[model samples]
Target: MKLQESTMHQNELINLNEYLLTKGFELSEEEIAKLVHVQKEICKNLKWIELDESKLYKIILPYTLSPYLSFDNKMITLENAILIYYKIRSMFDWHLDDETCITTCFKTYTSLYGIQDKELIKTIIIGLKKEGYNNNANDFNESF
Candidate 1:
């Protein structure tokens, strides 16, 4: 049940690709490979803890997909995506508390990346909520 043990699978990749397609992105093989590699790195860097696959996917998918999400009609660069992933991962490792992890990660990412897009923030909040995090839309209202 370790985080690394719940690494992304082929089905998940397919699902991710399908999800992206629904969002108007058709990822090439290279893009899919890059996502897999980055996701592995993200999981590898995290501390091992008992986490269910469903919960892990709910928590991690947003980080994996964030780079592709259009904010003000611009996609976030891969470099920025990796930085944001690690920043959130680092916070998760240090805090080890789901109650504050999402909020802290959101605050830190925005402070460093200067992301002010409401839709992107809402997507992240919704994803985290799927993992059963207590934070809600109200937690982010003042920021956006």
Candidate 2:
């Protein structure tokens, strides 16, 4: 998917760590490195990275975040807006990693939080619908 903003979002990722601090956890660079290493190792074990089959999972830049949520039928509820944004960014792994599969991750992950951020979610829902994802934008709020 095309990022609306042009910046690398490094500063935004740093800001996410600060917000995560209040959520009872700290996102450390060391931890992030380890996580990526582990992820890479797992990819290797699955033969997805070094082997063939188009390497379904791709690795690119790394970011971190923590997420929390709540919901009702009328409006989705979130514990923290900032947290969700951060989580969304990290979950965007498959999105930012490659152009072709970007939409796939974005569409599949919209409701992964179990709670939708009305504004941002509205944008994504519409975007996914336009891209032809199988999800009905209006029906999403039904699970809110």
lDDT of every model, 2 decimals: 0.47, 0.37
Candidate 2's C-alpha runs over 4 A off are 1-24, 48-103, 112-144
Q: For candidate 2, what's the RMSD? A: 12.2
Worst 10 residues of 1 by lDDT: 71-80
| Model 1 lDDT tens row, 1-144 | 445553555456567566566666645667656654655566665543324444333443454445435523222443344434443344323424643554445444445454535554455555556666554224444332
TM-score of 2: 0.32
Residue 115 displacement (Å), model 2: 10
The candidate scoring highest on TM-score is 1
* lDDT at position 25, candidate 1: 65
Per-residue C-alpha lDDT of model 2 across residues 12-122, encoded as one tens digit per residue: 445655555555455455644554465455555445443322121121211122133211221122122322332332333332334333333333334454333455555
